[model samples]
Target chain A: MKKFLSLHSLLSLICLLLVANNIKYLFVFIMSRQKVLNEVYYEPGYQFHTFLPHLKGVEKAGYITDLSVNRESNDGAYLQAQYYLAPTILELEDINYPYFIIDSKNTDFIIRTIKETKARRLANNEYGQALMKRPAP
Target chain B: MITIGYFLSFLLGRLTLDRCLKENVRLLHPCAAALLALVSGLGLSALLTFLTFVVLDSFHRPVIILVNISAIIIFLFFNRNLYIQKTIIPITDWLPWTKFRWFHFLYILLGVFIVGVAYVIALTHPYGEWDAWAIWNLKTRFLIVSDSWNLIFTDLHYHTHPDYPLLLPFINTWIYCFSADNLHPIPMVTNIIFVIGCGGFLCCTLYQIRKFSFPFLMGLIMFTTPSYLYLGTFQYADSLIAFFLLINLYFITMFQKTKDASWLNILGLSLGLTAFVKNEGLLMALILMFVVSVYILIDKNNRVGKSAVKHLLFTFLITFIPVLIFKVFIAPPNDDILPNINTSNFTAERFQILYNAVITEIFHEKWCYMWIVVLALLISRIWRAFNRENIILSIFFIIYSSAIVCIYVLNGKADLSWWLETSLSRILFSLLPALVFFGVHLHYSKQRGAHV
Candidate 1:
């Protein structure tokens, strides 16, 4: 007994067609960005794992800290860096501790920021994630 | 040792159920029963853990052990008649390799090779690719040390998607509680079992539906599919959700065939567990309800009895209640819905981006050909002559595919392109087994002429 597309199945098929069209338009938009499509599409491997070992320094500090940049910044790597590390980082309770990663280029600016916050820079972690400790309240 | 104890709890819970167990065991072939049992083992383990977390003021190891043992004893006492079974049907009798054809041997060799390759890949990246470490395993760490379980859902743990269900992490925590070690292999082994569970469930269900070398061929298709293997190795919830979805569909079909309402309860239980696996699972649960309702209305011979529908609804609630309490009472707000989505940006251009990411992945991704196969089969002449048995399955496929596209399109602050690129394939992977099962059933029904 073949029951071809009872109204239920027919409606389902129509719904699927509408969804496919919706998907097609989304593809068109991405392809429209010919310049950065390849870069964004072929972005190599996950950056989180590479950044994982460096975050261990932050973990050892046992204190909540601020990043040099805002958490919601559009920078690709930094955005995901926060995404991957925030859970472990947020558990830190030391209000005096502030942290940010610094390279040779920005070390002075970061140290200045730490000073302004009435904190002192601790040793940089191997991965360069920064740590700061605040004076007692 | 922890894995063994948890596994035993699941086995006992499943084996000692008189009503659901009898119907499931009787309807399914022995091989299917064993595979489904493995999946049910996880279901029981998660349910017990959830109960312990909710009932007791604290999650002490001793209390959990006592609960587990007590459950087994009570279920065993109630199901004494089952242990006194008069007949036995060994799986060997069902699949006699001695009589296999050459192609059968080919299927076996290929299955082994594919599984071996997948295992090697799993070993290469033991902690799972990304989500496993960031979200699932991170939550496990919290559960391991935190005296307060509610901390996981706090704003402090916002990045971990605290609103998502905790079955995987809770089981991992249980393992850690016993071993007192943070070894990576324990979680890796759990993922491997899920991989095997997916493959085994697929083959056994196909065999139960129609016996031939066909089940082997379908199993090979599932095993060799790059995305299926890849995600299975990664400690992602996608594979676990897929396993739960398959078991749900299998039982639903059995219910359709036998008109036995008891199977609906089993179906409800599986659907509830699916919701606990991931947030996407909640959507899947809704789809199951919608699809089954349509099937009931369209069914001519046995329109769903009122009591049957009541039982289905009640059991689904019973299974979902713990998660509901966790969400409403304990977990933090879901970040995916708000702050992420820009309702104002829902435009044609945005949709174009969503389509490009999804279609490109479908074409270029090493895995995900099953979706194409499903699309092809839907339009084929064979599909036009709908076997009534597949009504629920067809509806399920349509609803799931539609729902996924809608969800991706509605993304908030995350770059749509990046989000789609990273997740679209895994989302598709979750539905792969069901798609493959649909294909197998279609060709199978056509070949055998309505045997099942």
Candidate 2:
């Protein structure tokens, strides 16, 4: 009985429970690995990779998104876009830069933002994302 | 090319470790030495690469490689005689595997599965979670593309946390030096290495100190903690900080046992490297240095002496030179905490909120009841939790947690709930491994009559 109730036995029990509890994470990984590897999990930002060529030599750009930055989803998209199109700084909500990125599901919002900012659309990934150039003041 | 970069880093680390602990080389378990070498070597390489960027005023791959090679050459030259003496041996020979029991084999199997899961998670999120792409890897991208390293600190990029330390980004940038384009796998692989290194270091150190089952259990608990694996693969600097903190604790424990000044010096170096991982790491390093210094000064029984403090401080300051330069000269002011500090921000309600959040996080299912077990163990033997060796860790943990609370309370800029919800888990995650290590030591010290 003492051997059965030893510290090692107790710790082993805890370890066993821990492994049993976390086994779902492994299955979760297996289920999601293909989607993530295929960039389906990150498709919103993955779509912006094509804009890299257009963004070359661009120092700074403006960013406009329909979703508020406070939401986790919006922040993820904004940051991922920034990551994919780096070297070209993405200033959120300010369209005063030479170039700006439009990341939003709302088609009218993108059109209105570009039209109101007096920016011409330079490139668009055809998936509700675009790069626009603002007219110099 | 990336392999070459990692090889250079490992060689630099191995050689430097040999030189730093030449007299004590044989005293160290070969596995532990190799783990320390890898981490320290990666750190030194990052520092050297940062220095090269500063001197050249740009990211020059050739110069970066040249500087690293030069450092390796210097260490090799110094360690030439030690190598000739055949002091270093293969890690496989360090342990007597013939005497292994079934439980040991079970632990090994579990360890392998945990590591495999971690790698799969890393591969699944090749771009890492939000912070990895947004802050760390984003900064690396800017450094690679821009002519000036100061681009990350520009007023326009303040949202990227311009004031945060650049150790992670710099390490990624060093790997990027050998490639034509920014590869996503570099940071992924780097994070994996750090994760493995942290677990490996913990197990090997425990094996060295107390050749028993506790080491394997501590390691299993570390890897099996769901949040630890996720955060590690998330490619955040938290894992790096965790590794450095564990390294610091190991050095401290060794110093206490051996009373060797070299251990103290290595501890100093590790603390200095810790300062570069993140702002929280800087705070941790300062707190640890103070606690250890006080212990050295006041502990009459240990008799570590005054000179030992100087050795620690000097080595720490020497390795900390790059961090000092980066913080003072390059990085801009921290807008989050510094400007937002107000004494009026402190209140009873804030403390209540913090207390509630901490308690909630402690029992959160993400940790898989790991902390619950640790808390039970500590409470069951509360007195044994604060021995001479554990006191350093205990005091450090208390002060660091208090400091974190103060920072949250004093900063009115970020919404308290939002801030806590986003960051509190990762902060606790970073402390998890150290806490586990402390608990294992506490248990072993009690069982073995406090020798540990």
- Which candidate leads in TM-score? 2
Please give, for residues B1-452, the per-residue lDDT of candidate 2 as tens digits: 78788888888887766666666655665566777777888888888888987887678888889999998898778767765665453333325465477876765676577678788777777778778887898888777777777778873355578899988888888888777754677999899888877877777666655554545555666666667777888889998998999888877877877787888877888888899999999999999999999999898876668878998998899879889999999988788887998889899998888889889998887777778877765666568757886789889988998888889998888778778888998897788778777777776654543334
Candidate 2 accuracy as lDDT: 0.78
- Error (Å) of candidate 2 at residue B195 is 1.6
Give all candidates' CA lDDT scores.
0.62, 0.78
C-alpha lDDT (0 to 100) for residue B347 of candidate 2: 93
lDDT, candidate 2, at B17: 64
Off by over 4 Å in 1: A1-105, A117-124, B16-18, B56-59, B85-115, B209-212, B338-343, B368-371, B381-387, B446-452
Clashing pairs in 2: none
lDDT of 1 by residue, B1-452 (tens): 76676566456536532346463465565545655666766666666777787776345777766766777777667665555553532334323455567776654674566556566656556667667766787677656544556666753445457888888877665555567555366777777777777876787666655454444345545555555666788887777888888778777767876787878877877777787888888788878977786666656677556567776777788778877887788777687765566566678877899888777876764543545645554465355335677777777777777766666676665667777777887877777777667666666554543323
Interface RMSD of each: 11.9, 3.4
